[model samples]
Target: MLQIIVAMMLFFVMMFGIGFILNMLMKTTWFPIYLYLIVLLPLGIYYTWDDSMNFAQNMGAYTIVDYLPAITALAGAYISGTAIRSLRRGGYKMF
Candidate 1:
C-alpha cells in the first residue's frame, strides 16, 4: 500500500540524515551502523516485545510492511557510512 512505501521512505531518509550528521560530528564512518545495531535494534525489539505472547508469536507479528522499513533504515545507515567514507577518501576534510 501507499502507506507502507511512505513509511519505508520516511524511515530511510530519517536514518540517513541522522547518520550523516552523527558521522560528521563523531568523525567515524561506521558509528551509525553500531548505533543502529546496539541501540535502535534492541529498543525496537523491546518496544514490540510482549510478555504474555511467546517469542514466536511476538516475532511472527511482523509483516513485510514492518520489516521493509527496518531494512531500509539499516540500508540508510550503511549508505551514510559509505558516503562519509567516500568523502574522507576524496579529501573532503570537513566530512
Candidate 2:
C-alpha cells in the first residue's frame, strides 16, 4: 500500500513537472493535454500490448482504464497550472 502511494506520488510529481514545463513554453492548456496523450499513448501501448492481448483473448476487448491514471495526472496538472495562472492574472472564469 505504501509503495503504491509512493509510486502515485512520484507519477503525479513527474506529470506535474512535465506539464509545468510545457505550460511555460507553450502557454496553452489544451496543447499540453494533446502532447501528453500523444507521448503516453504509444508508450502505454508498448508496455501493455502483451497483457492487453491476453486479456482481450478472454474478455473480447481492451479498455483505456490502464492509461487513465497518467492521462488524468497530465490533465489535472495542466488545468491546475492554468487555473493558478488565471487566478494570478485576475481571470477566474474558466469558461
Candidate 3:
C-alpha cells in the first residue's frame, strides 16, 4: 500500500517534470501529449509486461484498468502543464 502510494507520487512528479521540460522546449499545448504517448507507452508496456503477464496468468485476463494509473498520470501532467501555459498566456478560464 505504501509502496503503491510512493510509486504513484514518484510517477506524478516525474511526469510533471517531463511535461515542464517539454513545454519549455516545444512551447505548445498539444505536443507534450503526443510526446508522452509516443515515448512512454512502449516504455511503460515494456516495464510492466512481467507484472501484466503474471496478473493475466493468475486472473485469466489482463485489462486496461491495469494501465490506467500511468495513462492518467501522463494525461494529468500534460493537461496541467498546458493549463499553466495558457494561464501564463492570459487565458484565465479553463475551457
Candidate 4:
C-alpha cells in the first residue's frame, strides 16, 4: 500500500515537472500532451524492469516488482517532456 502510494506520488511529480518545462518551451497548437504523458509510462516501466531483471540475473541478485512504477514515472516524465517539446515546435498550443 505504501509503495503504491509512493509510486503514484512520484508519477504525478514527474508529470507536472515535465508539463511545466513543456509549457515554457512550446509555442502553441494541436498536440496531445496529456496523451503522451499517459501512454509513455507503461513502456518505460516495461523496459526498465526487463533490463533490471537481466542485470540482476547476471549479478546473481534479486529484485521485487515494486520498483517498476517508479521507473515508469521517471521515464514517463522524460518522454512526456520530449513529446511536449516536439509538439510545441510542431505548433500545438493555446496561445
Q: TM-score of every model?
A: 0.95, 0.60, 0.61, 0.38
Candidates 1 and 4: which is better by lDDT? 1
lDDT of 1 at 4: 89
Q: How do the residues 3-42 of candidate 4 rate in per-residue lDDT, one tens digit apiece?
A: 7767767775776566556555564222234445466645
lDDT of 1: 0.94
How does each model score on lDDT? Answer: 0.94, 0.62, 0.65, 0.55
**TM-score: which candidate is best?**
1
Q: Which regions in candidate 3 have their CA more than 4 angstroms from the true location?
A: 47-69, 91-95
lDDT per residue, candidate 2, 12-77, as tens digits? Answer: 777777766666667665665676678765676566556535755633444444344665577567
Candidate 1: the clashing residue pairs are none
lDDT of 3 at 50: 62
Task: For candidate 1, write residues 1-95 as lDDT tens digits.
Answer: 99989999998999999999999999999999999999999899999899999989998988888789999999999999999999999999999
Q: Give the number of colliding residue pairs in candidate 4.
A: 5
Off by over 4 Å in 2: 51-72, 84-88, 91-95
List the candidate numbers ranked by lDDT, top first: 1, 3, 2, 4
- List RMSD in Å for every model shown: 0.9, 5.3, 5.5, 8.4
lDDT, candidate 2, residue 92? 47
lDDT of 3 by residue, 1-95 (tens): 67666666776677777776666666666666676788877675666566635755734444554554676678667765776677767855342
